[model samples]
Target: MTKIADLRSQTVDQLSDELLKLKKEQFNLRFQAATGQMEKTHRVSEVRKDIARISTLLREKRAAS
Candidate 1:
């Protein structure tokens, strides 16, 4: 899990890249859950929250500019 403070220090481009990666992982987790192959079910929510955190930070950065 990524801390909000750590995310806040990253550049927008870096945050975007991290968001994309998290989204991809989210997709895979959903697929695995559907197929009954998911091991760490809690990870789904963790990734989702991380994506939200990054998005919120990005918006804050844009608004501050």
Candidate 2:
């Protein structure tokens, strides 16, 4: 999980890259859940919230600029 302060310190490009990685992770988690091979079901929600947090931060940055 990424902290908001850590995210706030990143440049837009860095945040974008992190967002893409998180999205890929989310997809893999969903796939794992579908295959019944997932052990950490809680990670799904954590990834989701992280995605939202990054997205929100991105929006704020854009708006501020």
Candidate 3:
């Protein structure tokens, strides 16, 4: 799992890309859960948090820029 502080150290575009990837992963996780094939249920929450973290970092970077 990526931390907010770590994400804060990254560039805006990098953060955006990471956020998109995380959202995709989250979608996959949900799909897996729906099919009763999720091996890690906690991952759903983790991915959600990562998405929030990336968004926060992106917002901060934008504000700073």
> How does residue 55 of candidate 1 score in lDDT?
92
All candidates' TM-scores?
0.96, 0.97, 0.91
lDDT by residue for model 2 over 28-54, one digit each (tens)? Answer: 999999999999999999999999999
Deviation from native of the Cα of residue 23 in model 2, angstroms: 0.3
lDDT (CA) per prediction: 0.93, 0.95, 0.85
Clashing pairs in model 1, backbone N/Cα/C closer than 3 A = none
Model 1 scores a TM of 0.96
Models ranked on lDDT: 2, 1, 3
Segments of candidate 1 deviating more than 4 angstroms? none
Q: What ranges in model 3 sit over 4 Å off?
A: none
> Clashes in model 3: which pairs?
none
Model 3's number of clashes is 0
For the record, the alpha-carbon RMSD of candidate 2 to the native fold, in angstroms, is 0.5
Model 1 lDDT per residue over 1-65, tens place = 99888998899999999999999999999999999999999999999889989999999988998
Clash numbers, per candidate: 0, 0, 0
True lDDT of residue 30, candidate 3: 89
Q: In model 2, how large is the Cα lDDT of residue 18?
A: 96
Considering TM-score, where higher is better, how would the candidates rank from best to worst?
Answer: 2, 1, 3
